[model samples]
Target: MERAQPLPSYLVHRYQGWKATGYADNQSWYRRLAELGQHPRAMVISCCDSRVHVTSIFGADQGEFFIHRNIANLVPPFAPDGDYHGTSAAIEYAVTALKVAHLIVLGHSSCGGVKGFHERCLGRAPELAEKTSFVGRWIDLLKPGYERLGGNDADIDSATLEKEAVKVSLENLLTFPFVQEAVDQDKLTLHGVWNDIGEGGLEYYDAKSKAFRPV
Candidate 1:
């Protein structure tokens, strides 16, 4: 095993600053959180985009939300195969162990993952179509959503497909038996949300309207 080196100077400076301010101000609260463990009320599955700050957007405090970030905030159909499924593992832990009351699939506009999937479907990104591309396979989970957008349409915009991706994930969540049980027993509620990063606007899926409404 390789020995880890010290953090970069900038990261060290930032850590020191946070320790002195954010950490010092909430010493007692932090201690209480450590002692009691976490009881977050919700789990947020979102994109790995740096611009999407999950905690800041919701004004969440420490131990308030269990979050999992991936290429496109996608959830695959329940596959019990004995393989490494990071996203599925997180979902199982959150639904069964954490028993979170709410599960949110948050997608954002201008998502690179969604765009890549779109391009690949249109035969523009042959690289992503390769079997060895990790990201290609990951975003392939969004194939269903892309098809919903009329896959062959050359003019399909990124924004439209981004929202559809959210709904696709929400649908896939139902494939997980535990998640289905929770919903059936009224113990858990599922939500699909899209964020307009540039405008700082939020939209939620309305089942009745089958459309995204501003929140």
Candidate 2:
């Protein structure tokens, strides 16, 4: 089958420019990274959204972060179910092997996974029920939060659901033995961050303030 769309002229020009200058600008850094291996100071768990590029957001170069991306940046409670635990396994390696000092769960505005959970819980979209797929199974992790919201169909707002989902994932992170041990032993600090793309603002979860505040 043919591709759905052709490359835009502007993007095609930019891609050509990148191909010409990228090697000169990036090759040395990549070579150094290869020689040094990764010694990232932080491990960021972010959503796998093309718009939410973690490195660009943080102004980071290659090898600056040990990164893992998943739907909604959700971290499920650790379980040995003989299934693929991609996110959990990455976290384990980042903590135990790389020994990163910080763990950041990066949530963002207009998250599809969070929105899907809200709709699923509220039963707003019955068609979603027919699509039994990975996203559906993944969002099931947020069921407790959905129940806690009292099943009031009116309370299923996207913003509220997204914020609550961040908290849920933060709590779920503690369920992992490696994460808990790291936090208890003062080896790592856990943080939840919400990026508002519309406002170009970042809100961080403050334990003392008990709310997400601008950073």
lDDT leader: 1
lDDT of 1 by residue, 28-140 (tens): 99999999999999999999999999999999988999999999899999999999999999999999999999999999998999988888888899999999999999998
**All models: lDDT?**
0.94, 0.85
Candidate 1 Cα RMSD after full superposition onto the native fold (Å): 1.1
lDDT of residue 133 for candidate 2 = 69
Q: Which consecutive 10 residues in model 2 have the weakest lDDT in total?
A: 151-160
Model 2, span 1-215: residue lDDT tens: 57678889999999889867985688777788889888999999998878898887889877789999999888899897988999889988999999999999998999998888777666885655566667888888878877777655455767667777788888998988888999999999999999887887888999897788889
Model 2, residue 123: what's the lDDT?
A: 80
Each model's TM-score, in the order given? 0.97, 0.87
Scored by lDDT, model 2 comes in at: 0.85
TM-score of 2: 0.87
